[model samples]
Structures are given as C-alpha cells and as structure tokens.
Target: MDSHPLKTLLHHHLASDASAVQHVPYTLASLTPAALLPSPHSSKWSARITSLLHAKTSDARWAGLCLAQKSALLSQPVMIESAQSWIAVALPLLAVRSLFLPRLNLMYLRTKRKESPPVLRAAIRLLRVIFTTATEMPEFQRQVATPNVAKFTVALISLVETCLDEELKILLLSTLTRIIPIYPTLHRPHQPALTALCFVYLNGNACKPPNAKLTTAASQLYAVLHLTGGKVGAANLWRKAVDDALDFGWTALSSIRTTFLADGRLPQVQSASEPITSVPLNLDRLRCCIVILGDLFSAPVHRLVQVPLGALVKFALALLTCSKEEKVETHLDPTTRMMESLATPRIWALSCDLITALANRQVFLGEAGPVHLTTLQSFGSHLTPSAPRIATCIAFQLEQELTPSERLPFLDALEALFSRCYTTHATLVVNRLAKTVLPCASSVLSQQEETPVVELESNGRSKKGKRVRDFEGDEVFKIRQVVCPTTVDGQIVLRAFAVLQLLLRNGGLSPALQSIVCRVCLSALLALAQMTPASLSPDVRLHALLSATIQKTCVEFASASVDGLSKSLGLIVSTCLAAGTLQHEIEYLLHPRLPPLLRTMPGIEALSLFRTEESEEESHLIKSFGLASVAPSAPPVVRAGSEPVTLLPKRQPTAPAAQPLAPAVEPPAALIFRPTPPAPKPPLKAPSPALKVGPAPAEAPTLPVPMDVEGDETNEDMPSIDLDSDSDSE
Candidate 1:
C-alpha cells in the first residue's frame, strides 16, 4: 500500500522542479539498507531499482546508478541479490550509436549525446563498487563475479576504445586494473588490448595531447598488468619493455647529440653516413622512456632481473653532460628552439630520477658489498666533475622541511658520493660534508634541552583538607624523554655525524684543511656531549666515541703538525673546562695521549693541573675523614715523565744534636720521588753508637723535582706516589 522508500527519496531528490542536486547525495546517503530493503520489501526494492535503471530519461538513470553504487557499498547481500540487473542495465549506458551514410562516406558516433557525463560517471563508479564488493567475499566472487568476467571485460574495453573524454578513459583504465587482479586469467584474453591502450598514453602518442595524470595512471596499470597478469612471462615482458625503451631512447639521444655538443656547441664534423630512418629528438618521448625505466626499476620485480646499470649510468651521464651554452635566438622556429632550450634541463631532471631509482633499489636490496661498491664507483666517476653542482643541490634540498623518507635517501646518496670520491676531491667533499653536518647536529643538540611543561591532577588531599592545587610543572610531570635518538631530529643528527666521521677517517685532507675539519668536528661533538640528556643511557657510549675520535684526530695531527695538534688540544680542553661537561671525556683523552706530547706547549701544564686538581677534589669529596681528621693534601702535579711528583710532609727539626736519637724512619715507597732512578743508591751501613753526636748534615733542600718538560716514556715504569691516600705509610 505504501510507495517504496527508494522511489520516494529518488523522486524527491531528482524531481524536475529540483533546482539543485547538491543535497541529493547526502539525502540519499542517509538511506540505510534496512530502510530501503526491509525483509518485506526487499524484492520490491530490487524491482524498483531495476525499473529505474531501464528508464529512458537521463535523470532516472543517474538516480538508479547512484542507488546501485550506494547499495553495493551498504550491503553486500543486496549487491548479490540485484547485481545481475544492475550490470545488465549499466553496460548498455556505455554504448554509443554510429550512423553510417554509404553515399557520402560519413559516419557519426554520438558518445556525448547518447550518455551524459553525470550518467557515465555514475555508471563507472557503480561498476567499480560492484567489483570491489565482490573482491571482499570469496563466495560472492565465485558465484556472481566469475561467470560475468568476460562480459564485464568486453564492455569495459569497448568503452575505453570509444570513450572521447579523458577523465572517463582514466577511470576505465583504473577499473580494469583493479578487476584484472581479482581474476587475472579472466582478463588474460583481453590483455593485449589493455596493454596497447596503456601504451598509447604512455608513449605520448595518443589522439590528444599527453596528460600527466593520465600517463601516471596508465603506467600504474601497465605495471599491474605485467605484475599480476601472470608470472610465467612477467620477467621477459619487463625485459622487452626496458630493451625497447632503451633502444628508442638511445636513437633519440644520438640525434640530439648530433645537433648539440656537451658545451652546447655545434660539432665541427658530422657523421657522413646517417642511419636510415633516424628518429628525430622528441623530448616528450624521451621523458616517457625515462619514466618507464624509473617505474620498472622501482618495481619490486627489478630485484629478480639483472638491471642494466652500466647502460643506465652512461645514459644519465650523457644527459647531464649536455648543457646549453647560450640562450636561443629570436629568429629560430619557436617550437623547435623552445624544445631545444627546455630539453636539456628536463632531460637532466629525468636522468636524475632514473639514477635515484637505481640507487634506491640497490639500497633496498641490501647489496652494499662488492655490487654496491661497483655501482658507487660508476656514479662517482660520472659525478666527479659535477660534484659542486650536485653538492649545492643536496644542500639546498636538506635545508627545506622534508619528511624523513625524503631526507634519508638524500643523506644516503650524499654519504655514498663522499665516501667514494673524497680521496680525489677531499676539499670539495669535506667542505660540503661540514656544511651539511653542523647545522643538523646543532639542531639536535638544541632539542635536547627543550623540556615542555605538563600539568597533572593530584589524587591525594592536601594536609589542610583541601583539594591539591593544580599547576604546570617542568620535567617532573612530563614524560621521560627517549634515551636513544629515536626522533626525526635525532635521526638526522645521527646520520650527519656518521657522514662526518666517515669523511674524517678517509678524506685525508692536507694539514691546513684537516685542522679546520678537526676543529669543526670537535666543536660539534662537544656540543653533543654537553647537551646530551642526563637520563640518556647512551651518555657513556657517546662520551667514549667522542673521546676516541678526538684522540685519533690528535694523533693524526700530531704526526703531521705539532702546532695544529696543540691548538686542537687546547680548544678541546678549554671547551670541556668552560662547559663543565665531558670531564671523563677529557680525562680519557689526556691520560694516554696528552703526556706523550711536549709539556712546554702552552696550556699543556694548565690542562694537566686542571685534571689533577679535579681528580683530587673528587677524591676528597668521596673519601671520609674519621674522628682523627687529617689535613687535605695538595694535588700531585704531573711532570715531564708522565708521572706525578708530590712533596712529602716536611719532618720537624730533630733533637738538636741531642745525645741519643731514635733510628730515622724511612719514608714510604709511594711517598718517595726518585728523579732518574737515583743512580742505584749505595746500600747504607748501620750507624755505630759513636757515629754522629754533632748535628746531622743539613739535608740538602730537595729541589722541587724538576718537572719533566718533555714528557718522556723512559721513566713510565717507575713507581709513582698515590696522591689520593691520606696515610703517611705505604
């Protein structure tokens, strides 16, 4: 007795009097499967939708297509029940009538006139929904989709061939790609047609001008066809595509080379015998070929095949080498000259893309051994001349706000370039490495101190029987910061540091250049150590690494130039002392490496004194003095022989020539300081009772044992005093 809800909503929304259909989608979306197809009215709902789809008017068909798509999305059961009727009517809407007049030899195909855009778009969406819904349920696919695969394939291909609208064609291609994977064999019969259609747009020889969006979609479809079409001949298919593209690209490149030289000058002598049917240089065609190569290389299947790295590298090099010498003249043909002017840069960009694809693939496969080394060698050879230009580009990109995905690859590329080429181009590479590393490291160090404020509610009552106050607090209420460099900032900083270390170890810069580099490295590392979070677990390890690097740098510089080493050591000690951080780091550096150097060098004694004093202070603080307290001892000063010299407590003037004096007690071994081993002192004879009633020879004033100005290792094995002890005994 009641009109169907589907019909009622459709009539209300699609009425001829309705001025705007803007609200129709939302109004229709509100209808649920239960409301449209109640148990009692399910059959009637299907009947109503079928009748509407078969209606003559465009509005009726649009409403029906919209309902079909929504229904397919809402309830898979409803789709299964009425899919036949939906497909039956939707396929007819794509057909265009062609009228032929034999006498005049004219044919008229009315695509737009027959099917309006609204109806066509809706039909495509509805079909996509149907295929997608079928894919989710195996039962539905087996019973409903498997039987109709051929029919659907034929209809979609027919529309693709005759469709005049670009948007519609793209939609058709996308849908075909989606459905092909559902039942790859079902679409096998029509694979050739689909492949050809995709290539039409891919090759940029379509009936209309090339559309980037369309070409991208076509490339995606092409890859899917080969990837999922069948695995039997997939590799061969990829190989053939790559080979054909390379052949065509090389031909086009040769033609361009003949026209323009590397420096943009015309060649003095041209080849006498030109190839028959020389392909003219088409920039679009060239770009398409490069894009294809990029896509093929980027695919996961690339790992299974042997990529032509040599050919790819050579091609990229040739493209990068070809540069325009001067601007185009006004008298030349506008199209030809514009292509020539724009061609080089665009080709260069595409070539770079190809190179990136290869690099990323190599990295992804984890082939970083001999194979990767060979690849890097190839890139380095080609990239040596353009190192500055490439470095500039890399630096400029790094300065931008890039996501981790983008930043990481550029970093990897930069590292690869520097590692292979720094031997010959140390200055250029080292300078760029510094420029890239310092800023990123500084940024990470800055973030370590940023403790954001957080607020918390207290559960316990105050002592006054009032609710605890609410306030913002720093660090106490904030979550504990991560210890490792897990964040993006930390990752960038870590990567930059790695690159810096790599260059420092292998770059082999001259003394002057190395000093500059060592200075930069020390500054960055000190900042990292000083600002490193207290709670971070890597603190000890980071400090150790920093010390090791500094030690190695110092040793290297000392071997080459002592003055530079002194300056670097001075900078390091001064920075550590000033910041009051990296105390352990400085100790590690100074303990073994510092004593071997000349102590007369400025700041060397001060550094030694500072270390000794700090150690004494720490010992005093840690060691407890019992009730029988003792005076704090002075720090033992480090002398030239890498051993500390301490002055023993002066004894009271004994018994002024008194009659009997107790036997003199010898000083403890640790308290004794022997300069030059005391020349194997003669064994002393026992003193006779008659010996010495007069005053004992006044003990020669112990010269403050002359400090070892040149730290010598000969006395390194001598027994040294323990300044940390308070006891006078050994």
Candidate 2:
C-alpha cells in the first residue's frame, strides 16, 4: 500500500530545505536516545519569507509570482495582490469622494455596519498604488465631471476606509484631505466627504466657488464657517472665501448676487421646493460678504480711488443691508449674547482702510458730500462702541485727513470708546491707547490739568485753615496702583513696553519731557527696567524693547547739562543697575550716556568715583587710581656710557641702597629735565610782502643767494646727511 510521508512532506516543503529530511523519523521507536536533531529551520524560513515580501516588483508579474509561492493555507495571496492594485485606483476616488466619508461612516455605523462592504484592505492597498501612480504617471489627470470616474473614485475611498485600522484613522483622514480636492468632485450625495475635504483643505483653491456640487453640498456652509478656528477664524475665513470666489470669476459672483436680487431676497442653501416664509440669511454667507466689503475698505486707497462714487455708495449700501434680518444676534454663550449689529459691518479696521482710501482723493467725497460723508459719519458712530484696539485702528485711518476737526463726532466717539476701555482695567487699555493717543497726550494732559484748577475757588484773603484746591484732573501720571499691583502677564507687559518704546523713538518723547507727562513716562520706564525675572522673565524681544527705550531716554538726557540731568540720569542709571539688570543694561550707558555725562562732569569725575567705590577691593581700587596715569611702558632711567640716553627700566629691583650711614639722605634732586622751552616759539613772522599784497616793488637785481630753500642745510653740530641711493640706507 502506498502511504504519504506526512513528516517528510512537512519538513521538506514547509521548512524551506531538503536538509530537514535527514532528521530521524519518529526516532526509530525511541529505544536508544536519538542523535541530537539538526537545528530547526523556523528562523531561516522567517527570514526568507521577509525577503520575499520586501522584494521589488519589476512588473505585475512580480506580484503574481509572489502569489504563486505563498502557500495557500498559510497566507491569503489573492487578498495581498488585490491590496496592491487597490492603491493605484483608490487615490483619485478618495480625492473626489473625500467629502462623503464622514457622513457615510456615521450612517453605516448607525444602521449598516454589517452590510457595509468589506473593502478596507483593498482600499488601503489601492490608495498606496494611486499615490505611487500620481508621482510616477505624469499624464494621469483627474476627470471630475465624468460620472463613471467619480463613482469609481468614491468606491475606492469607501473600500480603503472600511479596511483601515483605527490607529491609522486620523492619518488616513489627513491624507484624504490632501488627495480629495485633486479630483474635485461635486456630487450632492458626497456632501459629507466634501465637508471633510474642506476641514482638511485649510487653504484649498476650491474654497472659491460657484460650482453647483460645492454649493449644493449640505455641509459646505458649516465647513466654511468652522474652517478658521474661532471669532478671528470666522472673520478671516469669511474674508478669504469671498476673495477666492471673486478671483474664480465675476460671473459666478454675479450669479450669486443676481439670485439674491431676484424677488429682492437672499438665496437660502435649502431647496426652493421646501416651504418658506422668510429665507433667513446664512450666517456663513453673511460673514463672507462682510469680509469682502471689509477687504474693499481695507485695501490700498488707490485700488478703489477710481471706483465710481455712485457705485461705491451703492455697494456700501448693499453690504450694509444685505442680511435678511436687520441684525445678527448670535447666542455665543449662555449669559452673553453677541449682537453683530451694524449700519453695516463697519468697524475700526474697515473705517481705516476705507476712509484712508476715500481721503486719498478727498475731492471725490467733497463732490459727493452729504451722500458720501453721511455714510462715513454714520459708520463712525456705528463703530463708537468697538474695542479700544478697533477704535485706535479706525482713528489712525481717519487721521490722514487734512483736518480731523471735520470729523469731530467721529473723534468724540473714539474718545468715548477709549474712555470705556480705560474704565475696564486701567493698564489694560493704557498700552493700546498709548499707540495713538500718546502722540497727542501732552496736549491732552495739559488741557485736563487746567480744567481741574478752573473748578477750584480761590480765596484772596488768608483763611485760618488751609484751603482745598482741586488738582483732580491733573493726575494722569498716577497709575491707580501704588504698591506693585498684581503683575501683568509677560506678553501684556511686553506689549506695553513695546508701545512705550515706540512712543520714545517716534516724535512723542520731547513733548512728554516738556509736560507733566515726563513723570509718568519715567515711572513706566522704571517699572520696565526694575521688572524682575521672577516677575516677568525678560525675553529677547522685551529686553530689546526696554533697551531701546532706555537709550532714547539717555539720549534725551544727554541734551541736558551735567547738573541739569544729574537727578534724572541718576534715577535712570540706578534703575538700570537694579537687581535684574544685565550687562546689556550698561551697554547703552557707555555709547552716548556715560561718555557725554563723563565729558560734562570735569573729566569723568563722577564715573571715576562710581568705579572707585564699586571695585572688588578698596586697596586694589586705590592702587588702580595711583597707577591710572602710568604708561604701559616702564618709567625712563639714564643708562651709563651713552650721553644720558633714556631707556625703560627693567622690572628687576636693584640692591637696596646700602643702609645710609646716617638716616638715608634723601635722593639728591636730580637735574630736573624739562623739555627745552619749546625753542622759544619762533617769533610770529610779520605779514609777508606777498601775503600783504603791498604795492608792486621795482624788480630787484636777480642773483642766487645760495640759500638752503629745500631745507638741505645742516647745522655744524648736526650729523652729516647721507644720501645713499638705496631707500634702506636712510
């Protein structure tokens, strides 16, 4: 009877070698101990399998060959091969169907997890192939409009997602976001996928669109709204989307506008077939329009300089009234309702950009007065309650006008806005207000100081008791905090210092010094310089800002005489020398401050004194002073045998003079050598005839006097001159 050798079959074919057959079969009934068996082939088999799996493929046949070799019971070869092919086909599908995945996943999980197609492995493999193909195939472009291609693409995405392990889900989502927009599909059913793509496509070009597929997608609006991170995000994204849409084509914009204008209504994302009372404006769309108008206002004045006044007015009005309702009341939190109300969404940033544009060519507004200025006047009032930062931004914008007095109401509104900002937290708004208001603060403070005194009643006669005078309004210098108030966060403090630095560098310091403002300014600088690392670690930027301000203060003080600046400079220098001051703190002092102060103080007397007292040892400091004027080269001595030729004495000491027999006779007063009295300074020559331009003289007899005009004559005692041809001989 023929019987299969199961052991041999298992060892030879499964173990990757014929050598496995040499092992004893069943150990010959186990009576004697079997000779030690050969090493197991498991390790070698594993290595061989790994190599095969990693082997490069020259063609599809390589995959086919790999499939042929893998044992059927041991592996799923077909599944592996299909995974390879799926990568190439799925990439574009994922790109196009990218929007639908999230929603479909939600639906499938809720109602059809078991029924959903088992395409995850196939999907992942296909995605790999597609990415590879994209890099390799130069001519493979996506065909977004074709239904066949779109459907296939969607199927591929669905497959890859189903097979992806949970650990890779986030990574897969990220990849799909980049890949999906490449196919650019607009299927209505694929809204969720498109939304997902938008979340991923932080700055995608498709974001600008009149494309029906994108417009029809239910989640598009939300995706756009949520695209940016928060309040600022909404403002930024809204601006970006409208700008992108405008760039895509004016016709697309016109279509959107025309649809809204028809029947004088805003178009709702919801279907026309659905019952409708009023199509409430989509906050997303409203925000987008606001951003577009904002862009118009904020862009360079020249860009809109030529825009017809009538058109500008019309667009402005349209933007102001675009919303379906008169105002936007978003309940952002349980306690606070943010009302995005506007005569238009006009605010400081908008005012600055727009008014600057109009004022660039004020004549246009002049011609279009009441109608034009009316809108601007309205805008200013509307923005009156805006943030201090916003108010400042707007004020700077209008400041370019030849006379801000023309816009007094607007200025008043700005004052009110800043006043409110100040009341919230004194320091909070000071730094912000300082940017614009500081420029004019001296005048403002002067006016304030005078007003309080005017309210005081003066008694001509002396009273028994002291009289009370109202200097109430003159106290702008006093920050409410006396003792160190709760310290501000580092960033805020840095910003405050930055603003102060700007004020000092720009034109404000002179005025500040001349007015009572100097005290507050000094206090601010001291606060900055004295700030400790424990309180607010000096970052490089904050340090630089403080250094610059200190230098400016030093420069201002430099203009004063030593006595005039003594107290102020002392305060400043001491403040800088306070505990946390670094070496950089003294750097500014040397450049312009200390040098000028030293010059003014009778030859560096003050700094010399300061240096002397501060040295590590008192005796050493005294020694330094005694040695200060000593030359680097040692003192000269007369050497023997060379006509009293001077030589620098060597550092070695001479034997102590033999103890003087009588108390050491004081050293004989050496012949004091004084520089020969400057050769009796040649008598000032009387004005020469040529220099005096005397009357022309009769020609004198011409004869050579043998004078040494070239300075060639030598005195009898002088060494004879040598005129060797070689320059070295001289």
Q: Give one digit per residue, the lDDT tens place, for model 1 in 225-244.
A: 65544666666666676687
Global Cα RMSD, each model: 20.6, 28.9
Over the stretch 106-139, how does candidate 2's per-residue lDDT look in tens digits?
2222222221122233234334334323323333
Give the TM-score (vs. native) of candidate 2: 0.29
Model 1 regions more than 4 Å off:
1-23, 28-48, 98-113, 136-139, 205-210, 261-281, 298-303, 326-342, 361-730
TM-score of every candidate: 0.48, 0.29
Most accurate candidate by lDDT: 1
Best by TM-score: 1
